[model samples]
Target chain A: MDNLFYAMIFIIFLTGFWIMLRQSNLIKKIIGMNIMESAIFLFLVAMGYVKEGSAPIATEANPGLAYVNPLPSALVLTGIVVSVSVTAFALGLTVRLYKHYGTMDVDEITRMRSEEL
Target chain B: MITAHIMPLTILLPLVGAYLILLVGSKHRSFARNFGLLTTGITFAMVCYITYLVSNQGKMAYYLGGWAPPLGIELRADPITAFLLLTFAGVSFFVLLFAYDILPGEINGKVITRYYALYLVLLGSLLGIVLSNDFFNIYVFLEISSIAAAALVAVNGDKLAMEASIKYLVMSTLGSGTVLMGIAGLYMVTGYLSLDFLAGALPQAYASHPLTVLMTLGMLTVGIAVKAALFPLHVWLPDAHGSAPTSSSAILSGLVVKVYIAVLLKLLYRVFPLDFLAALPLQGSLLVMATLGIFIGSIMAIRQRDIKKMLAYSTVAQIGYVFLGIGLFSEKAMLGAVYHVFSHAVMKSMLFLSAGLLIKYSGKRTIADLSGLGRVYPIPMIAFSVGALSMVGVPPLAGFMSKWYLGLGALEANQLLFLLVLLLSSLLNGFYYMPIVIGGFFKKETVEIRQEKIPLGAQISLLVLIAATFFFGLFSNIPISFLTPTVQGIFSAFGGGI
Candidate 1:
C-alpha cells in the first residue's frame, strides 16, 4: 500500500512536470507548475501516513495511539497555504499579462518583449 | 546591557516596524520614509550589536518565549545566521534609502505604504529564515518571504512585472513544496522537526537507515538549489530580479540570493554529516553545476540588451561562487564563501543600483545608448568602473578578495583544476562586465543623456559602497577575522576543525 502510494505520487508529479515541459500556453504552464506543487505535497503527506492510524490530535489517553507524525501535517498545511497565495498572485499577474499583450503563449510574450527590447 | 535579544529582536523589530508603517502611512512621502528608515536604521544597529555578540560569545540559542528546543521553535545565533542577518539588514536598509525617490512616483497613494509594508515584512521573513531553529518555522518563513517578494515584484502592476512575478512565484512555490517534503521525510525518520534535534538524530539515522537519509538529503538539497538559483534551477531569478524596480533589484540580487546560500549551508553542515554526503551518488554534481553556471551565465549575460537583465544573469555566475565554496568543503573555502556573501551584497547592490540610476536619470536602458555616459556622469561612471573591476576580480576590491580566497581555498584542497575554473570565470567576468563599462565611458556620445541628475541618497550609497569594496579588499584580514567566529562555529558544528 505504501509503495502504491509513493508510486502514485511519483507518477502524478512526473505527469505535471511533463505538462510543464510540453505545454506552450503560458497559463497552462502555470497550472502545470501548480499541479507539480500539489503532487509534491501529496508525496509528502503520503510519507507521513500509517496503515491504520488515526488523526494526531489526542483527547483520550492511549486511544489506539499509533498515530502518524503531526509535524509533516503542520508543514504541509503551511506549504498548501503558501502555494495557494502564490497561485492567486500569479493568476493576478496572468490577468494583467493577457490585458497587455493579448496572448497566453510563452513564445509570443518572449517575442514581443524581445522586439520591444 | 541587553543580554541577548538579537535572536527574536532581529525578527520582531522589522515586523512591528512594517505594521507601524502600514498603519500610519498616508500619501505623506516624508511620513512613510521616516518610519521605514527609522525602523531599518534601528534594525541595522541591532545587527551590528548582534555581530559583536556572535564574535565574542560564540553560538547562542534562544527559545521562543523561553520555550526550549524540540517543543518550541529555536533561534540560533551562530556565526552563519548572524553574518547573513547582518548583510540582509545592511543591504535592505540602504536599498530602502535608495528607494525613497523611486517608491513615491513608482506607485501612487496607499500603494507606496503597502510597498513599504510588504518590503519590511519580506525583510522580517528573511531574518526569520536565517535565525529560525525549526524546519517547519523555516518553511513558514520561506513562504512568507517568497510571497511578499513576489508581490513586491509585481507591485508596479505591469505586464513584465506580472509575468516575472508569476514565474518567480511558481518556481519558488515548487521549491518550498520540495523542501516541505524533505522536512516531512526527516520528521518521519527521526520523529524530530527541530534543527537541534535533527542535528543530533541525523547521524545515527543516516547510518542505520541509508535509503531514508538519501531521499531526505536529495529533496532538501534540490529544494535549496532551487532557491539559491543554482544553474538549471535558476530560470526564475533573471525574470524576477530583472523586471522588478531598481531598489527591489538591489535587494533581490544583493541580499536575497545570499540568504538561500546561507540556508543551504545551514542545512548541509548542521543537519547532514560529510561522511553521509560523501556516500551520495551525486557528490560532485553541485560543483559541476556551479562550473556550468559560471560559463553559461556569463555568456548569457553578455547577450543581453537590457542592463538590469544582464546584471541579473551575472548573479547566476556570482552565486556559483557560493556553491563552489561549499563544494570544496574546506574552512578556507567556507571562509571565502562566507566572505563573498558580504562582498557580493555590497558590490552587486552597487552595480544594480548604478544600472538602475543610469536607467532612471538618463533614460538609457540599453548598452548602445550608454555611449559617453561616463563623460556626462563621471561619479556614477567611476563607481560603476570600480564595481565592474571588482566583479572582474581586479585588485583592491571586494570581488577580488572573494575570488582570491576561493582560489587559495581550491589550491589548499589540492584541487588545481578548480583553481583553473576560478581563473577562467574571472576572465569570463571580464568578457561580460568590462564591455559595458568600457562602452559606457569610451564610446562616442551618439545619443547623449538628457539629464545626469542623481539623488543625494543614491549617490551617497554608491560612494559608500564603492569605498567599502576597496576597504574590505585591502583590509581583508580584519573583516575575515570578524567572520572567523562564524566560520569556526559552523566548522566545529560539523565535528571538523577550521
Candidate 2:
C-alpha cells in the first residue's frame, strides 16, 4: 500500500515536470511548478507515516499504540508555506509582464524583450 | 566579560533597520535617508565589535533558543564570518551615503524607501548566511538574500532593470530550489540537517547510501555554483548588476555574490568529506569554469562601452580568481581565496560607488564620457584611479596582494595551468582598467561646464575608502595575519593535508 502511494506521487511529479517543459503559457508553467512542489510535499509527509497509526499527539488513552513521526510533517508545513509565497510572487510578476507586453506567452515576452534591450 | 549579547545584535540591528524604514520611511520622505544611515551606522559598529571579539576569543559560537549544536541552529562567528560581516556593513554604509548624494529626485520617494528596506534585508540575510552552522537554515537565509537582492535589482522599475532582475530572480530561485532538494535528500538519508549532523553521519551515509549521498552532494555543489555565478551560470549576473541602481550595484558586485560563494565554501569544506570531494568530477569542472570565466570576462570587458558594465564584467574575472584558488584544494590556496574575498569586497564596492557618483553628476555612462573626468571630479576620479589600480593588481594596492598570494598558492600546489590563468587575467585586468585611467587624466573634457563639488557625506566616505584601499593593500600584516591561524585550525581537521 505504501509502495502504491509512492508510485502515484512519483507519477504526478513526472507529469508536472513534463508539463513544465512543454508549456508555453506562463500561467501553465507556474501551475506545473506548483504541481511539482506539491508532489515533493507529499513525499515528505509520506516519510513520516506508519501503519495503523494515529496522529502524533499525546492523550491519556492508547499511550502505547503506534503514531506518525511529527518532525517531517512540521517541516512540510514550512515547505508548503514557501511554495505558496513563490507561487504568489510569480503570479504578481506574470500580471506585470502581461501589462507591460500584453501577453502571457513566455516566448513572446522573450522576443519582445530582446528587441527592447 | 559583562556583555556577549553583541552576537544577536549583529543580526537584530539590520532587521530593525529594515523594518523601521518600511514603517516610517514612506510617510516622511524627509526622515528616510538619515534614519537609514543611523541604523546602518549602528550595525557597522556591531560588526566591528564582533570582529574585535573574534580576534580576541579566536572563535564565538552562539546557539539560538538555548539549544546546543547538533540540535539548535548555531550562529558561529569564525574569522571568516567576522571578515564577511565587516565587509557587508562597510560596503552598505558607504553605498547608502553615495546613494544619498546621487539619487535622482526623478526616482520616486516610495521606491527609494522600498530600496532601503530591501537593502537592509539583504545585509541581514548576508550576515545570517555567513554565521549559519546548519545546512537547511543556510538555505533559508540564501532564499531570503537572493529574493530581496533580485527585488532590489529591479526596484528601479525600468524595463531593462525589470528584465534583468526577473531573470536573476528565476535563475536564483531555480538554484535555491535545487539546493533545497539536495538538503531534503540529505535529511532523508541521515535524519539530520545540521552541519555537525551531516559531518558525523557522512561516513555511515557514504557507505550505506552512496547513491543518495552522491546525488545530494552533486545537486548542492552545482546549485551553489549557479548562485555564485561560476562562468556558465553567470549570464544573469552581468545583466542584473549592470542595470540596477548604483548602490544596489555596489552591494551586488561587492558582497552579495561573494556571500553565496562563502556559503558554498562552508558547504563543501565543512560538511562534505574531503575524500569524497577529491574523487568527484566537480573540482575539475570548477577549474574549467574558472578558467573560462577569467578569459571570457576579460574579453567581454574590453568590448564594453558602458563603464559600469565593464566593472561588472571585471568582477566576473576577479571572482574567477577565488574559484581557481579554491579548486587548487591546498590550504594556502583556500586561504588565498578567502583573503581575496575580503580584499575584493572592499575594493570593488569602492569602485562601483565611485563610478555611481561619476555617472550621477556627469550623466555620462560610457567609458569615453570618463574622458577628462580627472579635471571635473578630481577627488572621485582619483578614487576611481585607486580602485582601478588595485584591481589591476598594482604593487602596494589590495588587488596586487591578493593576486600575489593566489598566484603563489597555485604554484605551491604545482597547478601551473591555474597559475597561467591568474597571470593572464591580471594582464587582462590592466587591459581594461588602464585605458580608463589614462583617458580620465589625458583626454580633454569636451564641454565647458561647472565643476560640482560632491556632497560632504559622499566626499568623506570616498576619502575614507580611498585611504582604506591603500591601507588594506600596503599595511599587509594586520588583516592577513589574523586569517592564517583560522585557516590552520580548519586545515588541521583535514589532517593537515592541504
Candidate 3:
C-alpha cells in the first residue's frame, strides 16, 4: 500500500514536469512547476507518516503513543516558502514578457526575438 | 577559538555588508560602489586569513548556535573548501570592482544600489554553499544563490534580460527541487542531515535499500548537472549568460556555474561512498557525455556570430573540461579541474569585461563588426588577446597547464581517448579564438569607430585578471600544491589507489 502511494506521487511529479517542459503558455508552465513542487511536498509529508501514529506533539493523554516523524513536515514548510518565491518571480517576468511582446506563448516570443535578430 | 569564528564571519560579513550597502546606497550612488568594493576586499582578506589557518590546523569545523550533532548546523573548511573560498573571494573582489564602472550604464541609476545588494547576497550564498557542513543548509543556500543570480540577470529590465531571467529561474528552480527531493530521500533513509553522519550511514543504507539509494544518486546528479550546465542539459546557459550584463556575464560564467560543480564535487567525494559510486556506471557515462560536450560546444562556438554568444558557447566547452576532470577520478585530474576553475574564472571574466568595454566603445557586437578594432583600444584588445591565447592552451599560460595535468591524469587512468579529446578540443578552441585575435589585430579597418574613454576601475580589473591568467600558468605549482592534500584525502578515503 505504501509503495503504491509513493508510486502514484512519482507519476504525478513526472506528469507535472512533462507539462512544464511541453506547454507553450508561460502561465501554464509556471502552474506545472507549482504542481511538480506540490508532488514533492506530498512525497515528503508521506515519508514522515507512520501507520497508527498520532500527532508529533507531546501530550499527557498519549504519553506512550507512537508519533510520526516531524522533520519532513518541517522541511516542507521551507520548501513551500521557496516555491512561493519562485512563482512570484516567474509571474513578474511573465508580466514583463507580455508587455514587451504582447504574447504569453513562449514559442511566439522566441520567434519574435529571432526575427528581430 | 578565533579560527572558529572565521567560518561564520566569512558567510555573515558579506550579508551584513549587503544590507549596509542597501541602506547607504539608496541615499548616495557612489557610496554603494565603494561599500561593495570594501566588502569584497575585506572578504578576500578574510579568505587569506582562513587559508593560512587551514594550512596550519589542517581542517576546521565550527558548530553554529553553540549546538552540536544532528541538531545544530556546522560550518567546516578543509583544503577544498578553503581553496575554493580563496578563489571565490579573490575573483569576486575583482568582478565587483569591474562592475562599479560597467553596471551604471547597463542598469538604471535608481536600482543600481539594489543590484550591488543582490551581488553581495549572491556572493554570501555561494560562500554558504561551500562552507555549510550539512545537506539541508546546502539546499537553502543553493536556492538563495539561484534566486539572487536570476535577479542579477534581470537587472537590465530589458526584453532579453527578462526572457533569459525567467528561463534561468524556471530551469534552476526545477533543478533545486530535484536536489531537495534527493536530500529528502537521503534524510528519510538515514535520519541524518549532517554530511559526516550521512557519509558514515550511507554505505549501510545502500546495502539495505539499494533502489532508493540509486534513485537518490540519479536525481541528485541530474539536478546538479542541470545547475552546472553539463552537456545536453545546458540549453538555458547560452541565452542567460549572453543576454546578462557584462559583469553578470563574467560572474555567472566565471563563478556561478563553477560553484554548482564545487557542490557536486563535495557531494560525490564526501557524502557518497566510493563503492556505491563504483557500483554504478556513472563515472564512465559522464566521461563519454563530457567528451561529446567538449566537441559539440566548440563546434557551436565556431558557428556563433555575436561576440558574447560566442563566449557563452566557449564557456560551455570549458565547463566540459571541468567535468572531464571529475570523470577521470584521479588525483591529478581533480587537481587539474580545480586549477582550470581558477584560471578559467580569471580569463573568462577578463574576456567578458574587456569585451563589454569594446562593445561600449566601438558599438560593435558581432565579430565581423569588430574587425581591426584592436588598433584603437589597445588595453582592452591586448587583454582580450592574452585571454584568448591562454584559453587556446598556448605555452606558458594557465589553460595549457590545466590541459597538461588533465592529460597526465588520462594517462594515469589509462584513458587515452580523453587525451585525444583534450588535444582536439584545444585545436577547436584555437579555431574559434584565433580568428577573433587575428581579425581584431591584423585585419584592416572597414568602418570608422568612435573610441570612448575606458573607466579606470574596468581597466585595472582587466589587467589584474590578465596578469592572473599568466601567473597561474607560469606558477602552476602553487595551486597544484594546495590541491594535493585535498585530492590525497579523497583518495585516502577510497583506500589510496589510482
Candidate 4:
C-alpha cells in the first residue's frame, strides 16, 4: 500500500515534468513547473505521516499517541516559499519576453530571436 | 570558538550588505556602488582571515541559533569552502568595479541601484551555497542565487536580454527542482538533513537501497550539469552570458557556474563514500560528457562572430576542462581541476572586463573590427593578450599550470587518451583566441575607430586580475597548498589519505 502511494506521487510528478518539457506555450511551462513542485511538496509531506498519527504538537491528553514527523513539514514550508519566488520571477520574465517579442510561445520566441541575431 | 564565528559571518555579511544597499542606496546610484564595494571589500578581508583560521585549525562547523546539527542548520568551512569564498569575494569586487563604469553605458540610471542590490543578493546566496553543510540549505541558497542571476541577466532590459533571461530561468528552475527532489529522496531515506549525519547514515541505507542511491546521484548530477552548463546541457549559457551586461557575464561565467561544480564535489566526496561511488558509472560518463564539451564547445566557439558570444562558448570549453580533471580522479588531476577553477575565474573575468573596455571605448565587438585599437588602448589590450595567452596555455600564466597538472594527472591515471584531448583543446583555444590578439595588433585598420580612454576603476581591476593570472601560474604552489587539504579532507572522509 505504501509502495502504491509512492508510485502514484511519482507518476504525477512525471506528468508535470512531461508537460513542462513538451509544452510550447510559456504559461503552460510555468504551470507545469508549479505542478512538478507541488508533487515534491506532497511527497515530502507524506514522508512525515505516521499510521493513526495525530498532530505533532503535544498536550497533556494522549501524550503517548503516535505523532507525525514534523521536520519534513517544516522543510516543505521553506521549499514552498522558494517555489513561489521562482514562479514569480519566471512570470515576470515571461511578461517582459511577451512585451518584447509579441508572443507567448517558446517556439516563436526562439525563431524570432535567432532571426534577429 | 572565535574561529567558528567566521563561518556564519561570511554568509551574513553579504546578506546585511544586500539589505543595506536595497534600503539606503536605492535612491542614490553612487552610494549604491560605494556601499557594494565596501561590503565586498570587508567580506574579502574576512574571508582571508577565515582562510588563515582554516589553515591553522582545520575544518570548522557552525550551528545556527546555538542549536546542534540535528535540530538546526550547520555551516562548514573547510579549506575548499574558505578558498572558494575568498575567490568569490575577490572576483566579485573587481567585477563590481568593472561594472561601475560599463553599466551606465548599457543600462539606464533608473534601474542601476536595483541592479547593484540584486548583485549583492546574488553574491550573498553564492556564499551561502559554499558555506552551508545541510542538504536543504544548499537548495534554498541555490534558488536564491539562480533567481538573482536571472534577474541580473535581464537587467539590461534589451530584447535579447529578456529572451535569454527567460530561457535561463526555465532551465535553471528545472535544475533546482531535480536537486530538491534528490535532496528529498536522501532525506526520506536517511531522516537527516545535516551532511555529517547523512554521511554516517548513508552507507547503511545504501546497502539496503542501492538503486535509490544511484537514482539520487543521477538526479543531482543532471540537475547540477544544467546549472553548470556542462556540454549538452549548456543551451542557455551562450545566450544568457552573451546578452547580459559585461559584469553579469563575468560573474555568471567566472563564479556562478563553478559554484554548482563545487557543491557537486562536496556531495561526491563528503556525502557519498568512495567505495559506494565505485559501484556507480558517474565518473566514466562524466568523462564522455566532458570530452564532448571540450571538442564541441570550442568548435562552436569558432563559429561565433560576436566577441562576447565567442567568449561565452569558450567558457563552455573551459568548464569542460574542470570536469575532465574530475573524471581523471587521480590526486594530482583533482588538484589541477581545483587550481583551474581559481585560474579560470581570474583569467575569464579579466578577459570579459577588457572586452567590455574595448566595446565601451570603440563600439566595436567583432574580431574583424578590433583592428588598430590594440595600439591605441595598449593597457586593456595588453591585459587582454595576457588573458588570451593564458587561455591558450602559454607558459608563465595560470592556464598553462592547470593544463600541465591535468596532463600529469592523465599520465598518473594512465588515461593517455585524455592527454591528447587536453593538447588538442589547447590548440583549439589558440585557434579562437590568437586571431583576436593578432587582429587587434597587426591587422590594418578597416574602419574609422577612435580610442577613448579607459575608466580608472575598470583599468585597475583588469591589471590586478592580469597580475593574479600570472601570479597563480608562476607560483601555482600557493593555491595548490590551499587545495591539497581540501582533496585530503575528502580522501580522509573515505578513510584514505593522499
Candidate 5:
C-alpha cells in the first residue's frame, strides 16, 4: 500500500511532464507546469506523514503525542507561493505573446517569429 | 569580529537597496541609478573583506537568530564561497557601472527604476546562493534569482525577448522543480537539510536506501545541467541571452549560470560522500556530456551571423570547460574549474559589455557589418579584441591560465583526449573570435558608419575589466593558491584519485 502511494505520485508527475513537453498551446503548457508542481508538493507533504498522527499542535491535554512532521508542510507552503508566482509570470508572458503573434499555439508563434526575422 | 557580520550584510544591503530603489525611484528616476551603483559598491567592499578574512582565518559560518543548524539555517563561507562571492561582486559592480550610461538608451525609459530594482535583487540573491549552507535556503534563493533573471531578460519589452523570457521561465522552473524534488528526496532519507549534517547522514542513508540516493544525485545533476546550459540542455540560453539588454546579458551569461555550478560543486563535494560518487559512473557521464557540449556549442557559434547570438553560443562552450574540470575530478582540475569560474566571469562580461557598445555605435549587430569599427571606436574594439584573444587561450591572458590549469588537470586525471579537446576548443574559439578582431581592425569599411563619442563611464568600466583580465593572468597564482587548500580538502577524502 505504501509503495502504491509513491507509484501514483510518480505517475502523476510523469503525466504532468508529458503534458508540459507535448503541449502545443501556451496556456496548456502553463497548466502542465502547475500540475507538475502539484505532484512534487504532494510528494513532499506525503513524506512527513505518520501512520496515525494528528495535527502537529501541542496542548495541555496531550503533552507528548505523536504528530505529523511540520517541516514538510512549511516547505510545501513556500513551494505553493513560488508556484503561484511562476504561473502568474508565465501567464503574463503568454498574454504578451498572444498580443504580438495573434496565436496561442507555440508552433504558430515560432513560425510567425521566424518569418519576421 | 567585524568580518563575521560582513556575510549577512553583503546579502542584506543590496536587498534593502533594491526595496529602497523601488519605493523612491518610482517617483524619481535618477535616484535609482545612483542608489543602485552605491549599493553594489558597498556590497563589493564587504565581499572583498570577506575574502580577506577567509584567506587569512579560514572558513566562517553565521547562523540565523543564534539558532544552530538541524533546526535553523546556516550561512557558511569557506574559501571557495569567498572566491565566488568576490567574482560576483566585482563583475556586477563593473557591469552596473557600464550600464549607467548605456542602459538608459537600450531599455525602455519607463522601466529604468524597476530594472535597477531587479538588478539589485538578482545580485543579493546570487550572494545569498553563495553564502547559504542549507539546502532549503539555497532553494529559496535559487527561485528568487531565477525569477529576477527571467524578468531582466524580458525588461527590454521586445517580442523576441519576451518569447525568450517565457521559454526561459518555463524551462528554468522545470529545473527548479526537479531540484526541489531532489532536495525532498534527500530530506526524506536523511531528515537533514544542512550540508554538514547531510554529509554525515548521507553515507548511512545510502547504506539502507541506495536507489534513492542515486536518484537524488541524478535529479540534481540533470536539473542543474539545464540551468547551467550544459550542451544539449542549452536550448533556452542563446535566445534569452542574445535578446536581453546589454547588462542583463552580461549578468545572465557571466554570473547567473555560474552560481548553479557553485551549488553543484557544494552538492557533489560537501553533501555526498566522494567514495560513493566515484563508485558510480558519474565521472564518465559528466566527461562525455562536457566534451559534447564543448564541441557542439563551438560549431553552432561559428554558424551564427548575429554577434550577440555568437557570444551566447560561446558561453555554452565555455561552460563545458568548467564542467570538464569538474568531471576530471583531480586536484588540479578542480582548481582549474574554480579558477575558470572567476576568469570566465570577467572575460565574458567584458566581451558582452564591449559587444553592447559596438552594437550601439555601429548601428549593426552582425559580425560582417562590424568592419572598420576598430578605427572609429578604439576603446570598445580594443577591449573586445583583448577579450577575444583571451578566449582563444592567448598566453599571458586570463583565459590561458584557466585552460593551462584545466589541461594540466586532464593529464593528472589520465584523460589525454580531453586535453586535446581543450586545445581543439581553443582552436574552434579562435575560428569564431579571430575573424571579428581581424575584420574589425584590418578590413576596409563595408558600410559607412557615423562616429559617436563614447561615454567616460563606459570607457572607465571597460578599461577596468581589461585591466582585470591582465591582472588575473599575471597574478593567477594568487587565486590559485587561495583555492588550493579548499580543493585539496575535497580531494583528500577520495585519496586524490578517481
Candidate 6:
C-alpha cells in the first residue's frame, strides 16, 4: 500500500517531465513545469506524513498524541513560492517572445528566429 | 566576536543594497551605478576579512539566531569556501567596474537601474549558496540566483535575449525541481536538513535503505550537473550567455556556473562519505561525461561565427576541465579543479569584457570582422590576446597553471588518457583562440576602421583583469598551498594522503 502511493507519485512526476520535453506550445511547457514542481511538492509533503497523525499543534488535552512533522510542510511553502516565481518569470518571457514572433509554438518560433538570422 | 557577524553581513549587505538601489535609483538613475559599485566593493572587503579569519582560525561555522543545527540553520566557511568567496567577490567588483561605462550603452537607459538591482541580488544569492550549510537554504538561494541570472540575460529586452532567457528558465527550473526532490528524499530517509546531520545519518540510512540512498545521490548529481552545464545538459547555455549583455555574459559564464560546482563539491565531500563514493561507479561516469564535454564543446566552439557564442561554447569546454579534476578523485586533481575555478573565472571574464569592447568599437560581432582591430584599439586587443593565451595554457599564464596541475593530477591517478585530453583540448583551445589574436593584429583591414576613444573606466577594468591573470599564474603556489590542507581533509577518509 505504501509502495503504491510512491509509484503513483513517480508516474505523475514522469508525466510532467514528458509534457515538458514533448510539448510544442510555450504555454503548455510552462504548465508542464508547474506540474513537475507540484509533483515534487506532493512528494515532500507526503514524506512528513505520519499515518493517523493529527495536525502538528500542541494541545494540553492531547499532549501525547502523534503529530505530523511540520518541517516539510514549511519547506513546501518556500518551494511553492519559488515555483510560482519561476512560472511568473517564464510567462513574462513567453509574452515577450509571442509579441515578437506572433506565435506560441516553440517549433514555429525557432523557425522564424532562424529565418531572421 | 565581531567576526561572527561578518559572514551574514557579507550576504545581507548586497541584498539590502539591491533593494536600496531599486528604491533610490528609480528616482535618481545615476545613483544606481555608483551605489552598486560601493556595495560590491564593501562586500569584497568583508569577504577578504573572512578569508583572513578562516586561514588563521581554520573552518568557521555560525548558527543563525544562536540556534544550533538540526533545529536552526548553519553557515560554514572553510578554506575552499574562502578561496571561492575571494574569487567571486573580486571578479564581480571588476566586472561591475567594467560595466559602469559599457552597460549604459548596451542596455536601454531606463532598465539600467533594474540591471544593477538584479546584478547585486545575483551576487548576494551566489554568496548565500557558498555560505549556507543546510540543504534547503542552498535550494532557496539557488532559485534566487537562477531567477536573477535569467533576468540579467534578458535585461537587453531583445527578441533573441527574450527567447534565450525563457529557454534558460525552463531548463534551470527542471534542474531545481530535481534538486528539491533529491533533498526531499534525503529528508525522508534521514530526517535531517542540515548537511552535518545528514552526513552523520547518511551511512546508517544507506545501511537500511540502500536503493533510496543511491537514488538520492543520482538525483542530486543530475540536478547539479544540469545547473553546472556539464556535458549533455549544456544546450541552453550558449543561447543565454551569447545573448546577454557583456557584463552579464562575464558574470554568468565566469562566476554563476562555477558556484553550482562549489555546491556539488561541498555535497560530495561534506555530506557523503568518501569510501561510499569510491565504491560506486560515480567517478567513472563523471570522467566519461567530462571527457565527452571537453572534446565536443571545443569542436562546437570552433564552428561558431559569433564571437560571444564561441566564447559561450568555450565556457562549456572549460567546465569540463573542472569536472575532470573532480572525477580524478586524487588530492592534486581536486586542487586543480578548485584552482581552475579561480583561473577560469578571471580569464573568461577578461575575455568577455575585451570582446565586448572590440565589438563595441568595431561595431562587429563576428570573428572574421575583428581583423586589424589591434592597431585601432590596442588596449582591448592586448587584453584579448592575454586572455586568449591564458586560455590556450601558455606558460606562466593563469590557464596554464590550472591545466598543468590537472595534468599532473591525471598522471597521479594513473589516467594518462585524460592527461592527453588535457593536452589535446589545449591544442583545440589554441585552434580557436589563436586565430582571433592573429587576425586582430596581423591581418590587413577588410573594411574601413574608425577609432573611437575607449572609456577610461573600461580601460582600467581590463587592465586590472589582465594584471590579475598574470598574478594568479605567477603566484599560483600561494592559493594552491592554501587549498591543499582542505583538499587533504576532504580526502582523508580515502586514506592515501599526499
lDDT by candidate, in order shown: 0.81, 0.80, 0.87, 0.86, 0.91, 0.92
lDDT of 3: 0.87
Instruction: Give per-residue CA lDDT, model 1, range B107-197, as digits (tens).
Output: 6555787788888988999889888888889888888888888888888887788888877876776677678768877886787888768
**What tens-digit string does per-residue lDDT give for candidate 3 at B260-356?**
9888887887888666687789998788778888889899999999899999999999999999998888878888888788788888988888888
* Ranking of all candidate structures by their DockQ, best first: 6, 4, 5, 3, 1, 2
TM, every model: 0.93, 0.93, 0.96, 0.97, 0.98, 0.98
| Per-residue lDDT of candidate 6, residues B1-498 (tens digit) | 668799999999999999999999998988999999999999999999999998898888889999999989999888889999999999999999999988898999999999999999999999999999999999999999999999999998898998889889988988888898899999999999999889899999999999999999999999999999999999999999999999999999999999999988878878888889989999999999999999899999999999999999999999999999989988789989999999999999999999999988878899999999999999999999999999999989989999998999999999999999999999999999999999999998766677788888889989999999998899988888888888887787532111
Ranking by lDDT: 6, 5, 3, 4, 1, 2
**RMSD to native, candidate 1:** 2.6
- DockQ of prediction 3: 0.72
Highest DockQ model number: 6
Clashing pairs in 6: none
Candidate 1: list runs displaced more than 4 Å. Answer: A26-34, A40-68, A111-117, B26-29, B106-110, B485-498
Candidate 2 lDDT by residue in tens digits, B1-498: 423767777887787888998899888765668788888888888898888988898788778888986667888887777887887888788878777756644255568777788888888888888888887678777878887888888786776777677667667766776677677778878878778677778879889989879988887877787788888888888889999887788889989889888987787777776777889887898889988998998999999999889988988887888898788777678877887887788788888888877777667788887778777788888888999889888989887788888888888878887878888888888899988889888998654434677888878888888888788888967877877777666666742211
Candidate 4 lDDT tens digits, A1-117: 988887888887888888889999999999999998998998999898998899988899978889999989988999999989989988988888888888999899889878976
Q: Mind sharing the TM-score for model 3?
A: 0.96
So what's the TM-score on candidate 6? 0.98
State the displacement of the C-alpha of residue A11, model 6, in Å, after optimal TM-score superposition.
1.2
Docking class of 6: high
Each candidate's B-chain TM-score, in sequence, is: 0.96, 0.96, 0.97, 0.97, 0.98, 0.98
Give a tens-digit lDDT track for model 1, residues A3-56. 788778778877777776688686787777778778777866777777688888
Rank by TM-score (best first) = 5, 6, 4, 3, 2, 1
Q: Which residue runs does candidate 3 get wrong by more than 4 Å?
A: A51-65, B495-498
Better of 1 and 3 by DockQ: 3
Query: What is the C-alpha RMSD, rounded to one decimal, of candidate 5?
Result: 1.7
Given the true complex, what DockQ would model 4 score?
Answer: 0.81
